[model samples]
Target: MGILTDTTHLHITTWVVAVILFLVAAFMQRDSKGRKIVHMVLRLFYVLIIITGLALFIEWSSSDPMTYGIKFLLGLLTIGMMEMVLIRSKKQKPVTMFWALFVLFLLATMFIGFMLPVGLDFF
Candidate 1:
């Protein structure tokens, strides 16, 4: 539990794993073997991501409320985009827009996340 003792590590590890799972699920063929299982695991990571992310925000938001709030909102939107992509994909509809939005949110979130701990005031 040494590394887990650091909230940053916990948050980052789960975040990376969640994204990896997402990429895997996204590329897998429709109704392919293990698709549901991969998605279920990905969902669990989403929960962990929310929990750990909230904890980080609770601690860090005091320092920069604006950035934290934006990050939190972006996180929510990222998840929403992920769900939208999945739903649209399942319905055999176009998810190109949703996927683009998801990537943008993910990049923004990570950029701000790395900057936050260092007290960077780019915003």
Candidate 2:
């Protein structure tokens, strides 16, 4: 588990890249092939984020399962909201609610992650 000895950094990096990709895809023309390619890449990053997040959760759950569990769920919801917004937008549907939820969940997940024991000591 040497490579996964520190999944925190890997998880953060994946999510950050995912967010950037999401933004890029969101702003692109819905009918463009480039947007579709970026969306696919973003989905790959989503898998990476989930894997690294689960690794960290498994390693840190014993200390405070409740908080870690909450963060885990929030992270998943954030990802779901991101996907929903993109899909809806591509379908020419209104996604104002999904966009708001995506931002809210992302912020909450990040705040909790930074406050966790294994996370950065920013707070």
Candidate 3:
């Protein structure tokens, strides 16, 4: 496979992992230690995904600012929502809104990835 194809595969995998983490983190029972562990592992996976994504971006030297900008914004929103969820999870506060928006952001990321023209590079 070509380098671009390989990078695309990795990017898709990262997003898939992120989606799984979001679902697990959002819906798992709060009192379960196993759930907590799972959430932690998912968080770690997300961090890895983000780091790998950055490395890929740098390696590719993407030049399409619009796609990159959208992705960065979505990433920030996702992280912010996750932090909110974590903070409220301990307090048993309703976090449905956060989760809902997080999911939407994930979808938006996927949409941007799919809709953007190939070879439209970003820094």
What lDDT tens digits, residue by residue, belong to model 2 across residues 1-123? 445546477888899999999999999999999999999999999999888898899888899999999999999999999999999999999999999999999999999999999999999
Per-candidate TM-score against the hidden true structure: 0.87, 0.97, 0.75
Residue pairs with backbone overlap in model 3: 62-121, 62-122, 63-121, 63-122, 64-121, 64-122
Which candidate has the top score in TM-score?
A: 2
Flag the better candidate by lDDT, 2 or 3. 2
Candidate 3 Cα outliers beyond 4 Å, as residue runs: 1-6, 117-123
lDDT of 2 at 92: 99
Error of 3 at 18 (Å): 2.8
lDDT of 1 by residue, 16-51 (tens): 898888888888876776767888898998899888
Over all chains combined, what TM-score does candidate 3 have? 0.75
lDDT-based ranking: 2, 1, 3
- For each candidate, the alpha-carbon lDDT, in order, equals 0.81, 0.93, 0.67
Clashes of each: 0, 0, 6
Q: What would the per-residue lDDT of candidate 3 be over residues 65-120, giving only the tens digit for each residue? A: 66766776786677678767865886799888987887788677666666555423
Using lDDT as the measure, name the better of candidate 1 and candidate 3. Answer: 1
lDDT of 2 at 20: 95
Q: What is the lDDT of candidate 2?
A: 0.93
